[model samples]
Target: MILGWRKRRIARHAGKKNPPGNQEMELVIPNHFRCPISLELMKDPVTLSSGITYDRESIETWLEAGNFTCPVTNSMLRSFDQIPNHTLRKMIQDWCVEKQNYGVERIPTPRTPVTPIEVSEILFDVSASSLDVDQYRCLELVQKIQKWGAESERNRRCIVANGAAAVLAAAFDAFSNDSVERNVAVLEEILSALNWMFPFDVEAQKSLGSRASLGCMIWFLSSKDLSPKQDSIVALKELLACDQKLVEKLSDFEGVNEMLVEFVKKQICPTITKASIMVIFYMVSVAYSSSEKIKLAFVKMGLVSLLLEILVDSEKSICERALGVLCGLCSCKEGREEAQSNALTVPVMVKKILRVSDLATEYSISTISELCKYGRRDEGKILVEALQVGAFQKLLLVIQVGCGDKTKEKATELLKLLNPYRAGLECIESVDFKNLKRSF
Candidate 1:
């Protein structure tokens, strides 16, 4: 708009006096050439259901930000569907040529979006491996597909619908069999592609949790490569998330539990940290209830101190998952001892209640209960530590707040158990356990 005004001012003052507040006139950028969202010349203009044109990149960004209203019209967006403005694109190209003095360059035509059939054909290129070069070309194409799909939700669904999961796994297996450096690069790309597609492959998620596929993931996690190892754990987390039985079988894969602990202790990547926590969540989902050996495995890994360290300043999700894993590991005698070894364990648990979530409060209460109930020689000290750390006050607070009934009943029990240790505290005077009793 400023440029347009300046151009008019220059035309009106042709061979005459300069207009007030005007030093130099600039080229006026045409309104049609500008994208409403970016206010810049449109490269690949596409129209939405609101009959508004925008550069494909700008409009897609708007949609991805969860906006359902048109940026230009402020009306409801009828649909996310976009049609390419071929005529407008041609005009923009010609205008760029005419405006060469202004350093404008013609934009190249965008490639057609990758289709499901194209992904299937690329999988065939991977599977028909008469030579390593064929597999390499397929790897490059898979990378291209991943790039395109990540840019827009439409292409991501298209790639997933055409069985990108199985193709990626095939690429992993085929290239993994070869030791060539080129094949190593191919294998890295395959791992990445698999990680990107694994979460969306509904049918393939279950199938990929099979024993053989689980073994392949375990092998990757055991490797020394920092990059693929991170992707492997993330993919493993996606798989075990839907398959509880596979989680229970984590011990069935030798050294899987230990690898997860080492990854957590190293604190390599944030995603790795989150993925490791999730994997352990499923691992102990059922094992904590039925298997003492599983509890022993986690304790022996020093998971207690590890969790205590993360619970200090971790995010809510990570804090909750850590509490869950702690609740499970604290089931056995070994687990209790490991937790007791860490001085901050009691204090951290006492602090987490009413801070993270209702479920976190439950897990925190359960963990403290296990420590108080199962601590052989440390039970008395645990109660004293709880009182010293103000667990009594928090327990009363939990009962007074909107936590679940079961949580209230548990908190009441824990408080009653600790009452003898607190001889002079007003926080416990108002505590009433009459209505908080468990029916069962």
Candidate 2:
């Protein structure tokens, strides 16, 4: 009787006609054979505790996204465990085989999902392996973690939840002072693993913020290879954002500022460039007293010129941060002098005004104001440069369009400074005429 029923079902599928000019026939799949979550033929049908059957992969993804309720039923789930619906699976497979000539392919049995316990064991293997004694094994374990993370979002989250990030951080911290040549491959793998598991948990962040870890990152910043350098800067940026105290300590590290300046000069990639700029900004914009020292150190490294160069064609976020760092550096005497000496300073600042963002506009105006107020030589020339670069008109636009009170105040002051220089310049004639009409 079962064979007869199967043969009749196959004949029914075979009788379906192909649409005109089409080479293949569309199979009419049964509604009950499809997963509620995916609306597709269920390859590995699993019944949830809520009595809902779905494709295992689809439901797992749904649950991973923080939804605990049954998607279709809208009922609370008593358990996350999904029981395999063997009868439904057998039916779906039989249907697909019957419609094989109509472009339907049988689904292969899905592999078992990775468990948290399995991820924990991998992390344990990574922790037990030592780069100094067993570099090959260490690299292998770290690479396995990286491979798992790359396979699926669920696996990455699983690895991270099992403390992969913290383990890699501790490994990096432990070998931070070792020679780069001896542990370069292992270190790079560890960095790759950590990069894959970003937005590190609190424990991971704390581990990455240790003194040895900071030193390790500084060493990577100086590496001849670009990948590790990029990874290191990104990690450092995250650490600084999480732990404000690291900013102060990082500033005290000798040659760190110089390395960061060099990294910006290289401009390997936008992500790395932004990270390096932000790290520098944090170091130079800490507490006021120490900030001055940090600013001086960066200015001495020719950060002023570097910032101006960055401002020329940088994207919005990079431009804002570069301008911010410039503003901080300009607060010190040496920084202001360094900025004023750069030929691009006034024109770049002027061009940036009212162009990138409100914050960028404010920083540009503020930096130019500092130059005009404190420039030992050619304050008039700086004003003249401002006039020539359409600074006067942009500043006027900034005021008319409205901005924060501090920005508006700076614009007003800048306008007053540039007013005397606007006499013969053609750009200001309209403003002067408007003023004359108002006075009358």
Candidate 3:
């Protein structure tokens, strides 16, 4: 009887079985089986040199975040190596299996982390395969690099550190001259790999900014596939930021500015839109004399109208960038005329002032100042429109809220320009001018 009673007690303690249509009881995990960092059941348990066990991912993350010491003990690590705690992992797996009725599942075995030597071997294969001679082999190797890059941040860093970016860029430059139609698959794959390897090393960036690479990017931008186009624009944005020389070369590409402006006009996606705008901004903002040519090209392409449209209903960040580009474009006579011709220009500029941000306000006021200051035939009309759009009131708000000295100076100048027209317009009430503490 005592033996039977002991068996009953063991069954009762294991878990209480629920009746039909009832919720299952929660499983209680042992504290020792939990990782200290994640406070959850350990999947792939690993031991540090400090004698503490943690989940492999958790420990890797801790170290990756620049924490050299042990998380729980706060002691300096003697070695960076993490030894697998296979024994503990097995125990956790068994426990999970036993709790299968309670919705617990066993963790799959973790894959081995990629090492630098493995990345180097693949890169060597890539360099060996010629796109013209061994197209199949080249595609496979580039795809493998892309796969490894997608697996983990560690893998990406390892791949990049081993100079995968420069190798892939060189491969891309070599294949760039080929007909993109026949080799679209290989070219797209190469672009995908290169795109994944963003924040490239300076050498890699320079290679990307080469003439062949720039031409290749333009072709991708005009491609039917949205994915490659998105990737290409993002890559272009990064390249333009790193290399000023790329600006001049980029303008030389046929229909490049038109493609960039079309991307903005279509509003393909916010990421692509912002990147396209920034590329245009960089192209025109170059200190070199080619910038003037690029600016005129963009203005001829109706960029001012596109920007005015964007300012109508964009978010704060887009507004700021668009306004910045507008400011640059307005520095030239054609850009000022284009902006002045757009019915939305003065009203949008007024709406943006003191509303979006300090920078937006500054750009808005600066663009208006350019039109009013340098515009050929419609200077008075622009000032009158500024007055009509409640720009006068917004300028006062800008001065009252306080802004940078430059912005304030621009606002004061605009006030002086619009002050004469304020009394003539019906929109300007005496109360609007009552708050002024100083003359414009």
* lDDT to native, each model: 0.75, 0.79, 0.81
Winner by lDDT: 3
Q: lDDT tens string, model 1, 357-413?
A: 879989999889888777758877888888876788778767765678777777887
Better by TM-score, candidate 3 or 2: 3
Q: lDDT score of model 2?
A: 0.79
Better of 1 and 3 by TM-score: 3
Candidates 1 and 2: which is better by lDDT?
2
Candidate 3 C-alpha lDDT tens digits along 1-440: 01111112223556765455443343567887888998877777899999999988889889989999999999999999889888888888887777665556788776666888898898888878754535678899888877777777778877888998888887777677655565677778888888767787887887777777778888889988898899899998988787767787788888888888998999989999999998988887777867888899889888888788878998998999899999999999889888888899988888777666778888888999999889848988988888887888778777887778988898898888888887877253344444434424
Model 2, runs deviating above 4 Å: 1-46, 55-68, 83-112, 124-138, 177-183, 288-290, 376-378, 399-402, 426-440
Error of 2 at 90 (Å): 8.6
Q: Residue-wise lDDT of candidate 2 within 366-407, one digit each (tens)?
A: 899888878848688888878887788877777777688988
> TM-scores for all candidates?
0.74, 0.77, 0.84
Candidate ranking (TM-score, best to worst): 3, 2, 1
Cα RMSD, each candidate:
7.2, 7.4, 6.7
- How many steric overlaps are in each model, in order? 0, 0, 0
